[model samples]
Target chain A: MRKTKNSVSYNKWGYIFLIPFMTAFIIFQFIPLLNTIYNSFFENYLVGLNQVGPTFIGLDNYKSLISNGDLLIYTRNTLILWVMCFVPQIILSLTLAAWFSDASLKLKGTRFFKTVIYLPNLIMASAFSMLFFTLFSERGPINSILIQLGILSKPFVFFSSTIATRTLIAFMNCMMWFGNTTILLMAGMMGIDGSLFEAAQVDGATSTQVFFKVTLPLLRPILLYVMITSLIGGLQLFDVPQILTNGTGDPMRNTMTLIMFLNNHLYSKNYGMAGALSVMLFIITCILSLIIFKASGHDKRK
Target chain B: MENKKTKGMSVHARRTFSYIILVLVTILCLFWFYVLFINATRSNGELQSGFTFIPSTHLLENWKNLRAGTLPILSGLKNSLIISCSCVLFSVYFSTMTAYAIHAYDFKLKKFIYPFILAIMMIPTQVTALGFVKLVDAVSIFRDSPVPLIATTIAAPVTFFYMKQYMESTLPLSLIEAARIDGSNEFRTFNSIVLPLMKPAIAVQAIFTFVNNWNNYFVPALVLKSDDKQTLPILIARLRSADFLKFDMGQVYVMIAFSIFPVVIIYLFLSKYIVSGVALGAVKE
Candidate 1:
């Protein structure tokens, strides 16, 4: 009874400790989230330095978003960019992880390789975008080098071609992230029991077979985590494309992403539209996350 | 014996192949930063002329030009430092406190709070951005101030989750009970005893939080209106988009290098921890 009372006395400290975080979340994140939903139902925009009505206009903003069809185009673009980057990122990371984690290989300088690759991930994305922008500019070093090497007769306009622009964005994203993915997947690979591989080897299995039959199966959870997080991150792809395309999403807006579209509304102070777009984005993220979870059989495992 | 020798030769060949590929990848990763720094040292006219392997002597000229240019590069640097440092402080300290609360105490809301925070972790910032900006502007005090940016950091779910995970593994309640028995108050014990034990987790999280906040542009672009208040990423973006008449590729490179310089320095010092911290996060999950 005395111990129970003593424990009860300490309970208040938990609530007290939580107050600051809870208060900030409620004010800065939670309430704003609800406000975004609420604002979606009202008409609010700026008209040439004039504040327009936050007047009630139920479903209109969402209606226009649907009717206009840009959402579909942007969503497709976002997904395409994500797939472009994610596929290469996963493959390269997997390959690197395999090489680094292979004990028989006894690869030298694995630590150096890991550190060098992750350096890109440390730099600011916006700054990295600027570096790319300058390097791939019409008369930039990349073009000049290629021309000097007789690969191209003239400087190619990278920002002008849709394929080149999209590829560059995807490539940059892949470059920035493959190292991180490599590290995560490497850690996952390392955690598998050594005996599992030894057992496979003794059973007349090749390395490839052991990887497929034993290694990959045990790596499902980490793979699932990487994919879902990458998917969510893919949905938030903004800084690279934003800075790369100069917020134009040019080359016929092929590089335009979902967050870029939302940013346009936010930029214009079109609260209703921005709010509506944010709601759609929120829903899409939820549905996609759920679909991924379901597809992975995560629930069954749990 | 002959067959085994051939197999050994093949294995050696494959290992050599892997080393070559890794070296190539390492070059691919480091080449851009080299190019960036090399370009930073060239004159604008030299830049327009063509690419070169060797850097030129125009680095000081470019630096002088960047300082003289309309962009508030130094102020932006200062703002970024202040903002990122403040964010690191708030995020690491408060998240540790919240994690400690959840870890140590057996309150009624213990089960609920843990999952609730985990659920909240998935809610991306872009979803809350529109309303955040609106709410900020509506509340006059928060408008055009870093308060919202700094305040919002207190609820960093990722950091909190990691801290809670760390505490669960390393922090023992018996330690806290012993401290209480020694007449140490909860706050005092947390400050002196708990914080010391959490240094590794704290250091790792602090570096990440600092780098993240320093590089953050989206929310800061919306929040800070004044030139002096802008962070480095924002300034770098503006520098890139500046009109052709005033455009200097050399200065642009210099400014970007300036922005990334600090982060690279910090990273060089703490990369081991950062890499391990990332792996730790994944393994814990």
Candidate 2:
């Protein structure tokens, strides 16, 4: 009876404590999610003096999204940039994490190294993007150095070409993220049982063999976590691209990502198209997340 | 003797290699910051001339440009502080309360709510951007009120995840039960007993939320349209995107410095906690 009373009061306190968060969640997150879903099916465009509120036009917006072909270009840009950044980031961070986590490779000043590497991760992406913009500008130091080095007769304008612009963005992203991934990977590695490494060594395993056979398998869950989060963040490629291009996604709109495009759509008051793009983005992310969850999660279950 | 010598040589080679890699990486990571600092003190003429690793004497001049308020740097700082600090407070405090409620109590929806919150983590605010802006604009008061910005923290699912994990590992239920037995009220128990115990988690989440909110440009850009209310990121963007001749790299560097100064200070002081906090959050079972 006493225990029952205690639990009853616990339930009441639980509801009380939950009210603030739930209230905000409903007001902010849940409603917006529902609204996005609702808006996606409408025909809303800024035609004249008045803003056209979303009106029901089932399947029209989504249909236009696929037909417009901008979806393909934007999606391609987002994926290509993400892949360019992520491939190098994952490989370098894995090796570093392995090297750092290895007790056998004990080196001093790691605290300093860790802080330095992670420093870029802490800075605002906009600020970092700004830094890169200055560095790679036509008259900036990078171009000057290249000219002085006799690598080019004239300054290689970074933003003047598509490949150069993409590469710069990718390099900046890789530099910022590898440190974070290293820390996470290192922590994941550290959490692995020491005896597993020892046991592999005892069984005449080379360090390479142990890493491939034991460490990589053990690192899967964390790696997937890092990858998926990176992918999600990578998918919403905005701040850097947005700032770097001054919200123009200029040079013929080459750098414009899905989110940036959606942003533009909203800015132009093409509310229906923006909603449709958002839904598509949401669906893409959900699919990607599910695939990753299955791939890593299946291994764990086995 | 020969085998021992070879083994020792390999170990020594490995350690040296590790140090070289680490040093190289450190230089790579910090090179831009070094550049940012070096250029902050240079004149626009000096900056456009070439890369100079040397610090020029124009920091004070840059400071003058920064405070001239062609862009509202000082007010941006104040607004950012007001926005991010309150954001951190709401994020850490309310997230903790929500986590505590779920962790400590026996409610019907406890099981459901836990995963429900986790599910929301996968939904980035970008997905709801259009509707969020619409809702805010419709409310009129909330349109640029800073309420939506601060209130967004209350539903911080990631912080709740960390705090819940923290509660499980560090905050034993027995202690709460003991407090309850002593006739302390539920809120009192949470306020007096629980919060102090969750200091480390609170500190960790506070730093993350602070940085996230401080650097957040997208939502703030969309919502805070007024020049006076715009944060540093927006201001910095404006500086960058300005007419080419008007782009002052020195002023830009100083503004960048000014924008991140508080964050750097906070991180420097709480870095040890920040590192551990990330580890605690990342490697959780």
lDDT of 2 by residue, A1-302 (tens): 99898779777899899999999999988888788888889998887777786679999999989998999998999899999999999988888888878877777777777776776777888988887888788888888878888887888878868888888888888997887888899999999999999999788676778889999998887988999999999998898888888887766778888889988887787888888888989999999999998887677766
Q: Please give, for residues B76-171, the per-residue lDDT of candidate 1 as tens digits.
A: 988898899999999999999999989998999989998999998999999999889988899999988888999899999999988988988999
Q: Model 2 segments beyond 4 Å from truth?
A: A48-53, A297-302
RMSD of model 2, in Å? 1.6
Error of 2 at B283 (Å): 1.7
Which consecutive 10 residues in model 2 chain B have the weakest lDDT in total? B256-265
Per-candidate DockQ vs. reference: 0.82, 0.74
> Clashing pairs in model 2?
none
- What does candidate 1's lDDT look like per residue over A1-302, in tens digits? 99899989988899999998999999999999999999999999999999999899899999999999999999999999999999999988988898889787788888789998998998899999988988998889999999999999999999999999999999999999999999999999999999988888778676678778888888888888899999999999999999888888989999999999988889899999999999999999999989988888854564
- Give me the candidate number with maximum TM-score: 1
lDDT of 1 at A140: 90
How far in Å is the alpha carbon of B200 misplaced in model 2?
A: 0.8
Best by DockQ: 1
